[model samples]
Target: MKNDEGEESRVLLENYRVLLKKALDYLWERIKVERREVKKGKRVITKVKVTLSKKEEVYKSLRDELEEVNVLASHYVDKAISDAYSVLRSWRRRAEKGKASLRKPKLKRVYVRVKSTLRKVEGESVRITVRPYEYITFSWSHTWFSPRVKGLELGEPVIKEDKVHLPFRHRLPWFTPLDYLAIDSNLYTLDAYDGEKFVTFSLRELYSLKFGMELKRGRIKSFASKHGRKGGKLMEKYSHRERNRVRDYVHKFVNKLLEMYPVTTFAIKKLNKQEMFQDADDKLSKRISRTVWRSIHRVLKYKAPLYGSLVKEVNPHLTSKSCPRCGRVSRKAGLSGVRGVGSPWTGN
Candidate 1:
C-alpha cells in the first residue's frame, strides 16, 4: 500500500529490492559445483552437482556483513537470505537438467517476505511490524473474499510495490480413490478410458484461441515494425488475452472432468517437451507448444485434491504401440496405435 508521500513507496520498494539483490549476490558467491560419473545400463554419464552455502553459515556471515539491513528488523535479514537461497536452489535444479546456464541469477522483483512472527491480527485489521515500534495495518472487513475465508488460517504476508498480499490456508483430509482413469493427451483432444469405455474432451476452442492469437500477433509484429509503441501495446494486449483465455478454457475442462469422475485415480502420460521438440519437426513442435501439454496435467494435479481425486503420470514410451485388449507390444497392437491409447496399468 502507498504511504502519504509518493516517493516513500518508491523508496520502500527500492530498499527491499536492493537488500534482496545484495543477499542473493552474497549467496551466489558461495556456490559449489562438483562433477561425478554414473553408470546406467551399459553407458556412463557425467553429472554436475550444484550447491549453495549452508543457511546457518550464511546467516552468521550476513548478520556481520549487512549492517544497514537492521533499519526494519533483524528477522528481515534472515528472510532475505532465505529467499536468496530459494532462488539458488531453483536455479541449481534447472542447471542440473541442462535447462538453465551455469551462471549467477539476478533477483528482479521488488517485494519483502513478511514472516508470521512480524504480523498481528486485530479484529478486521492486520498490523505488520516494520521496526520495533513502527507498523503497517490493512483492513479486510469489507473485502469481497473475507467471508469466504472465515474459518481459514492466515499465512505469511508478502509486501509488494503497491499492495500487501495476505495468504490463507485451508486444510483438507486425504481421500481414497475408487477406480482408475487413463488419459491420452493430443493436440486438440484428451482421450480417457475408465476400464469399461472411453471419453474424449475436445480442446478445439483452446486450439482456435491460440491459433487466432498467433495470426493476430503476426499482424501486430508487421504493424509494430512500422508504428513502434502502438503496435507493441496491441501485441501485449493480445498476449495477455491469449494467456487468460487459455487458462479459463483449461480450468473449465478440468472442473468438468473432475465433476464427472470425483474420487478417481487419473493416469496420464508423462511428457518431456524438450525431448519431444528435439525429435519433432518445426510444424509438429509448434502444434505441441500451442497445446500446452503441461498445463492440463499440472492443473489436474493441483485440483485433484479438491475433488478427492489423484493423478499419476506413467512413462510415455511405447504406450500407444502396446495392445490394450491383450498384453502384447507391436506396431499395430492397440486399437488406435497412432493415437497412442494404451492401458494405464500395463502401459499397453
Candidate 2:
C-alpha cells in the first residue's frame, strides 16, 4: 500500500513536469511561426489588430492541443502564451538597438504559471489543481508568511523545481513629510545630506566581495576549459552564491539606514546607467555594472512606505560637479578630486 502511494505521487509530479515542458515548446513554436509570417509580409506587427490576432491564434492552437495533454489547464496555457510574447518583445527591443543578436527564444527550464482560481488556500496548505479532478496539496510551517498572505491579494503562482512561489500585491499608506534626506549614491559609498547633517555609508566591502568572486570565476573558467562539465557546475555555484550575498547585504544595509534615520522623505539622483557607462573603461564599467544601484533604489522605494517615508528622484545633472554654496560648476573637481567628507566646494 505504501509503495503504491509513493509511486502514484512520483507519477503525478512527473506528469506536471511533462506538461510544463510541452507548454514551453508550444509557445516557442508559435513565436517562430509568427516571426516568419511577419518577415514574409503575410502579417503586419501592429500594436492592436495584428498583435491581438496573433495572440488569439496562439491561444486557440494551444487550447486545441491541450486536449491531448490533459494535465495542463487552460489558464496556465494562456499565461505561457503571454510569457512567450514577452520574451520575443524583449529580444526585438535589444535587436533594434543592435545590442543583441536576433535568435528564437529557447526553453532551457520549465516554468508553470498557476492562476489563483486553480489553487485554494486551506489553513497552512495550498491545494493546486494539476488536471481535471486531480490535485496536489503543499503545506508550509512558516507562520510569518500567514499574516502577509492574508493581507494582500495573491497573484498567479509560478512553479519551478519542487517549490511554488506566490506573488502578492497590496496598497501602501501615503507618507506625511517631516524631514527630507538628500542622498548621493556613488560607487564607493552613499553620501546623504539631511539639511544640516551629512552621513556616508561605505560600500567598499561590497565591491571587495564582488571582485573576489570575479577572481574565483576566472580561475573556475580556466579549469572548466580543461576539466569539462564538473568545473562548469562549480562556476555556476559560486556565481549564484556571489549574487545572493550581494543582494542580502544590500537589503540589510538599506533596512538599517531607513530605521536609523526615520526620515519622511528620501531624495535620490535619477541615474541613467546605460548612458553613463557607455563610454566608460572596461574594468570600471564592469565594477559599476555589478554595484546593484538600481536594486538598492528599488528596495528603498518599496520599503520606504512601511516606515511612512516617500522616495523622490532629483535631477542628476551637474550634481557633483556644481558647488552647492556658489552654484558654480567646476570641471577640474572630478570624482577623484571629491574625496573625504565635508563640502566638495571647500575641499575639506
Candidate 3:
C-alpha cells in the first residue's frame, strides 16, 4: 500500500491526526454548546479519493500520505478502528507472530456511494480506477443515499458534478453509506428494496454447499460411532475442505452481490442459528435461517459501503406467516406468525 518509502503513510497519518482532530473539535464544540462531555480521538473515517487526471499533482501528496497510512496501518488496523492508539495493541500481537509480524495493510481508496434519481433504473452501478498517487475514480449509475440524510452537510467532496447527483448527508461520509441499506436476505434468494422493487435473484448455491457440509458432518458423526479411535484424522480432512469451500463460496457470492447492487439496501432477518440447530421445535425453519444472518451481514457490512448502499436487519417474525395478499393478521388459518412480519416501526 505504501512505497518502500513508508514515509507516505506517516504523512497520511499526520493528515489523519489533523482531520480526526478537526472531527473531534467539531464534536467537542457542539457538546460544549449543549453542555456535554468532550471526547477526542475516537473514530477514523475511511474514504476512497478520486482525483481527476489534471489534478494529479494536487492529489499526489495526499495519495502518498494515504498510502503511508495504509502501510502503517496494514497490520494495526483491520478496516475498522475508533482510535489509532488501539492499532498499537494489535501490532504488539502481530509482533508475536514473528518477523513478518507486520502484515502489509492494503491501500484502501476513499469510497463514494452513488445513486440515481431515475425510477426506470433498477440498481446502482459503480466504476472505479486506481493509480499510485495519480488517479482514482469510483462512479455509480443509480441513486441510493438516504433521503433522510440528504441536504445535510457531511464533509463536502473535493470535486462534484451537478449532473451526477450525489446524495448529501452528515459529515460522517467515511461511514459506508451501505450502513443505511434495506437488505432482504434469504437462503433461497437475495432480494433488495433499493427504495424500489427488484427482481428477486437466486442464492441457492450457498445453501447447497452449506447443506452438503451439514450432511457430511452428520455422516461423520455417525461414522464416529463405528470408528471412534480409528479414523480421527480422516474425518478432519473432509471437514476442513468443506469448511474452506463454504468460506470461498461466501466470499464469491457476497462479492457478486456488492458489484451487482452497489447502491442497494439489505433486508435481513436476525436469525438465531444456535437456537436453530440446538433446538428442534422447527428444524426446517431454524436451519433455513441459521447461516443467513451472520454470514450475510458479516460480508455485506464492509462489502456494501465499499461500493455504496445501506443495510437494515428486519424482524423475521411473520415473513411467511401473514397473508401477502390481504395484509390481514392471521395466526391459525394455515398461516403462522412464528416467522415475523414487516415492522410497524419502519413506517415511522
Per lDDT, the best of the predicted structures is 1
Best-first order by lDDT: 1, 2, 3
Better of 2 and 3 by lDDT: 2
Per-residue accuracy of model 3 over 238-258 as CA lDDT, tens digit each: 789987887787778788877
Which residue pairs collide in model 2, if any?
none
lDDT of 3 at 23: 30
Provide the TM-score for each candidate, comma-separated: 0.75, 0.59, 0.40
**What lDDT would each prediction earn against the true structure?**
0.76, 0.66, 0.44
The TM-score measured for candidate 1 stands at 0.75
lDDT of 1 by residue, 1-348 (tens): 333333444555576566678887787778888889999668887788997788877687776666565466667777777777788889999988877888888666667767888888887667877767867777788788888878777788767766677787766676679787888887777877787777777778888889888888888899988998998888889889888988998889899999999889988899888777866798888887787669989999999877778899989877765645564776654554344223332353
Cα RMSDs, all models: 5.1, 8.5, 16.4
Candidate achieving higher TM-score, 2 or 3: 2
Error of 1 at 315 (Å): 4.8
User: Model 1, which residues run further than 4 Å from truth?
Assistant: 1-22, 33-49, 53-78, 93-102, 131-134, 176-179, 312-336, 340-348
lDDT by residue for model 2 (1-348), tens? 012234434554465555545665665554431232133245553221112236665667776665477555555555555666666677666655546564554556555666777888776666777667777666554645766566665566666554567666666666577887877777778887766766778888887888888888889899988878898888889889988999898899889988987756888777867766765678667867767677888899988876778898877766776554456777854656444322222211
